[model samples]
Target: MLLNHNQSSLSFHSELYSFVPEDHILRRVHDLVDFSFINDLVKESYCVYYGRPANEPELLFRLLFLQFLYNLSDERVIEDSQYNLAYKWFLGLNPEDSLPDSSQLSRFRVHRLGANRVEKVLEHIVKQCVEKGLIQSKALIIDSTHTLANAAKGKPLDVLKKAANRLLKGVKKQYSSLYKKLPMFPKLEGADEEKAKQLLQYLVELRNLLEDKLPDAEGSLLEKINTVKQIIEDERLLTNKGIASAVDPDARFGRKSNSRTFYGFKNHIAMTEEEIITAIHVTPGNEDDGKQLQTLVNKTREQQITIDEVFADTAYSRKENLTFLQTDEIKASIPLNPAVYGTREDDKFQYDKENDEVICPAGHTSIRKAKTGRTGTGTNPCLTFYFDTNICKQCPFKDGCYNNTKEKTYSISIKSEEHIHQMAYLDSDEYLQRKGLRSNIEHKNAELKNAHRMTRAKYRGQFGMRIQAFLTAFVVNVKRMIKLEMAHSE
Candidate 1:
């Protein structure tokens, strides 16, 4: 049950908090933010009239806030708060009052706030910033950073074996009698591929057995069953781009650059010029950065924050995105990707925007074009323009440009009038200045990883990653708001 929100009476020990200076960061944060809303946000998740008196949701939330603010683990945060006077004062606990057990932090995080409500934590914080007039700029910057998965990448066979063993163990542990009725682990005496098929078949049988016997299994057993189902249904299990770990099935392989890759999740973020984060979109590592632009924009707009301009890298320069900004009448300072505009050696080919065709160096225009390749894959989808080889065969430029190829084609990965207009805007002084503003978000990303320990996930699975990301964003935003407030006062 959620306890009452009555203020605790001051005790003799409470006076000891006087030693914590009024100018302390936590003190400033406590004054800046009215954390009482936390209680309301988590009220429904708690039992109102049943169970023993539970810790106040606000208090538990404060502990979590302190935990992320200091970059401490669950145990360490509770332990440190017990002795740290400033922490005690920030938590609004009497000096002698004992803290709730560290484990409560996880229970509260997983059950109370959870994935559904965690996002509200960030949204509420951003709302507070807007209310205070801390976020004044109409321009928002968008970017994404990677968080390494807690689980290591494993081979397909190893992943299958591990998942099966986990399911079997969970069944035995939870329902011993049911375990005995289930089929034993399948014997393997063949090549890796053959053994994998046998193990997969056994897992399917095992799932059917459990579903029949324990039709209402919940918690870890249900989770394990679901995990096994995922492993079974994944057709790309044997491929490199497939599930790499049963422990973190949500994570996928994503590239940091052409030479560097990371296996984990991405924290796609949108921030104001004030450096306060307005929205966060978490996805598997392999998710496209460009796809999240609309999500981030809509999320920011949800807060009633007017977004007249967006600053981002070339990844956000897709033709669709340019059109999106244009329709909304929002200014976009994103750099154009050469792939979208189609580059050439010494400008041998030029796009004729009016006719929607490419002009060869010899002034030969393309006849027809076809869009090829699947979008949202790692590869860039292109519009391939087929030129008549009949004209190329008799042209002087045929030797180097056309040769004797069956099809004389010029391909541009992306094309639109929006892109053409964007290309022209890219050279303007306004675009150049705003382009540099996007780099400021890079520092914020670094601070999140280096200072808050968001470089690697602290918990397993996508849910855990979302919890980590939003909470960290909350801490960072709170700190930034405090700084902004301080500056305003001076």
Candidate 2:
């Protein structure tokens, strides 16, 4: 067969595709990140898996890096790989090979990027940043943001019960239809019947009560009660579906915004002066930020890095936390709550250094109560002071001193001697020099939120959200490393 070819359509090319050099900044970043170190840390024997043996492992790894570096969604990443030459070069993709599907990317994220893997990758990035002189390991700013989970806005118990009853009625109709088709169908009676009836009845009652109580319930009480009722109804709904979970529960709610209570987790991050993410934590949504700080700090310590100072907001300013930081040889620079510092009532209780006693406003010195106490890890020694009941009761400022209580309260408190010492150290010019560097992490936070789109998490569940956060931090560190390298080249 003879065919006439159009010269314009059949034009010959010198090469399969013209190659462009990788960006200098991206190349420098690749050198600084140390992919092997990250692989060793994040890629576990059970966690790592390959679908097609021909697929390059490095390419997959780089895909995760891109997630944070560019803050691209899974679909966007696929589109970029197909259309954008820069993204193609970054992922080390050849000109002929087609980009991976979005679903494959999603599966890879879920099956391979578990909590431990994400943490390990983050630690490696932080270590690299420290080695490159990009991150200051000694000083750190720790903060947590609430990541909303993928759960629905739960309805009140009464409303949910009504809905469940409606569902049950539909299920019964289907069951009856099936029973008619099969003459020998098992009877849907006994415990199952009683359970169904009881659940339906309770739901109806709950719905009625909620409608009545909603108008009268004051402040947050109504919302709280409504949430509680919704949780109960949800549990019942799940039970009807013959489902149970030892881990995932309806009680789990997002911490990001209480208004958007969802089933997921919280992400806590510790950032260094060089904008490297030193540590990250993914916990249940209901977990308190105050409880996670010490654990995160401990984890950072385990990396063989000494933290000199820990900066946080008022949530971490409790006496227990202050004492913990002092004992750990780490300085905690948390601001006092306005109520605690602004009020002059506490000024009366002055510390008497000579006697280790607390002097009340009435010129009465209180003696020490306990010398030691036990914390989460071990015993902690502390000095406590208390005022005499007789003196406190007859004082003219007794109401201000004792909250108008007849008990004439005796309080036991741990005086942070090390905290006072640290405070003195912080007040020095040299310490102030280091403390001034803490503001850098704020800019880093802003970059992650605004530039990297970390202001809101893209994934649902604690594990997925954490992976996203880790990737964001990893990308931030890489960018910092790239900038540092460029500065050095200059």
lDDT of 2 by residue, 207-228 (tens): 4554563456543344334443
List residue ranges in candidate 2 displaced over 4 A. Answer: 1-28, 36-54, 155-265, 336-434
RMSD values for the candidates in order, in angstroms, are 3.6, 11.4
Q: How well does candidate 1 match the true structure in TM-score terms?
A: 0.90
Error of 2 at 108 (Å): 1.5
Candidate models: Cα lDDT each: 0.89, 0.58
TM-score per candidate = 0.90, 0.63
Model 1, stretches more than 4 Å misplaced? Answer: 346-409, 412-414
lDDT of 1 by residue, 1-490 (tens): 8888654568888878889998899999989998888888999988889998889888899999999988888999999999999998888888888999988899999998999899999999999998999998999999999999999998888888999889989988988887888887878979988887888788889888888888899999899998888888888887757888988888899999999999999999999999999999999999989999999999999999999999998888776788889899998999877676568667579888899999998998999999998865444578899898999999987767877889988888765567778878887888876678989999999999999998999998899999999999999999999999999999
RMSD of 2: 11.4
